[model samples]
Target: MLRVSIAQISPDGTKEENADKVEALIRMARGADLIVFPEYSLGARLEHADRLAEPVDGPLIRRLAAAARESGLAVIMGILESAEGGPYNSVVLMANGDAIVAHRKILLFDALGSIESRYVRPGNMPLTLVRLGEFTVGLATCFELRFPEIFRSLAAAGADLFVVPAAWYAGNLKEEQWLVSAASRAMENVAYLVAADSAARAFVGRSLVVNPWGHVELDLGKGERLVAWEISRDAVDEARSALPLIEMANQHMGTWARVRRIY
Candidate 1:
């Protein structure tokens, strides 16, 4: 069994304070094998995102990486990243004070009036699959949950888990749709789904972990807190064996089986 810790962060625009909260939570969840943090919980300088961005080796990420190394835990976290051209919304997979993988958000929510796209350059790379223990984990941001093809692609690439760091708004549509998406993603992909959400002033704080059988393993409250759960990889194998959606992945496969768009 693999234990996961979901850190529900409530940010006050102070990067140090947020980092301290995360660090405290990480220490509290000492026995966990993996720890997931919310997006932009460290702080957001919307107008000067490029200036505020940091590399994986920078202070913020380095601190988390250090904690992961000290605790012997794998960490999946979201942060604003600065590179050659500009900044981008990125998630890092880290262990032993080093980065294992970094995935940039491909689908920016610019059309939804989120100015994040204005500051962050859209990424062209596909979803990333990182090996953890006996399972492969897929990385994605909040908005990416609405796209089924993204999950399908990752599942096909042998992703057995999905980690989402989100900042969802406080509304019925957002809440309902997000829950639906989380459960559906787990049910369809037959993988474990862990969603860590920020508990901000105007956002909902329903951080959750859904199993391959679409069961809620853990659900955190809107208040700032850390929740943990243990999951077995055998559950994933069993779920897939029972409901073989993978076999039905491309029912429309013709002579051109490999050439098909994931509508």
Candidate 2:
């Protein structure tokens, strides 16, 4: 089993404040294998991404690496990752002094009266999955959850655990959709899924986990929280054997243009 924590906290402060919070969060997740943070967890708001974006190897990231290295833990968190043209709504994973852009949001959030493309550039990176002990962890961002193709691509590439971090907007049925989408993705792929969403006033704060069998294992309702759960690879195996849906439907599931794997 792998212990994973979701830092369901909003990035509603300055860069230094957010970075400090991240360090404190690492300290809080002392015993967990990995921790996941919501999208825009460093930028006070998505609108500020243009001005606040930082390179993968920038000082801010190096500081984050130092924190992770000190804690001897790994973390997945959203950042306004600097790139050509503009920033990418990117999620970075840091472990043992190594950090990489796990996945850039290929599908930007442009619906529900919000156009993320205004400041955020669409990512062309392939699907990224990480190896943690016995499980392959898939990483994706907020808006990507609406598209099952990305999750399916991760599963097709041998992912057993999926992580999604989001700044999901609050709207009529939006919360319901967030819950359903997270669970549906896990069920269809027979993989465990952990989704962390911003707890800010504008976004839904219901961070959740769905087991390999598509059961809601934990639901962190409304507000900042650091919750952890142990996920089993054996459960994924059992779900595949009992359901047999992935084998039958994988061929039809759309694939990403490319795929990348990391340790």
Candidate 3:
């Protein structure tokens, strides 16, 4: 069994304050194997994000890495990545005081009158999957949840669990959309989905965990808190065995069969 902690943070202070919240959350979830945080949880600066952007080896990331390692916990969280062209929105999975995988957000949040595309560059690179205990984990950011294609591709690429760190904006029907999207993605791919959302003033805090059977396991409704849930690979196996969606698609020999993409 793998224990995962979800840290739903709505930071209301300076950079130091945000870091303190992260440390406090990690300390609170000391026995969890892994912990996830929302986007912009590190710097407390969601707007004008480029100003506080940093490389993976920068001080902020290093400090976070050390803190998680010190707690004997693996962490996956979002940050603004520094680059010459695209200071991308990225997620880092860290262990042993080092980053194991950094996944940039492929889809920018350009909807709902929020033009993230204006400041952040879209991650054109392929998605990266991280290794957890007996599970292949796929990483995505806020806006990616709107696109089922990305989730489908991740499922095809051998990912059994989806880890999403979202900063979802509060607006008409947005909260319902968040819940539906979480359940839909899990049912469509027959994989577990974990959503860690920011409960900031502008954001509607409804972090969710959906099982492979499209069941909502846990939902943190409108608050800043940390919660844990235990999952096992046997659950994934049971879902796939019942659904057999992957089994139906991957058996054909198409010309582009090298990647095993489902139509």
Superposed by TM-score, candidate 1 places the C-alpha of residue 248 at a distance from the truth, in angstroms, of 2.9
Residue-by-residue lDDT tens digits, candidate 3, 112-177: 677887888888677988788888898888889989888877888888899999888888999999
Worst 10 residues of 2 by lDDT: 249-258
- Give the CA lDDT, 0 to 100, for residue 76 in model 2: 90
Candidate 2, position 110, lDDT: 87
Q: What is the lDDT of residue 14 in candidate 1?
A: 68
Q: What overall lDDT goes with each candidate model?
A: 0.81, 0.87, 0.84
Clashing pairs in 3: none
lDDT of 1: 0.81
Off by over 4 Å in 1: 250-263
- Please give, for residues 1-263, the per-residue lDDT of candidate 1 as tens digits: 78888888876656667777777777787888999988776765568676567777677777877877888888887777777788778887878778733688888766555666788887767678888777888999988888988888888888889999988767658788878999999888899999998888667779999999887777886878787888889998888899878656755435546576899
Report clash pairs, candidate 2. Answer: none
Better of 2 and 3 by TM-score: 2
Candidate 2 stretches with Cα past 4 Å from truth are: 251-263
Best by TM-score: 2
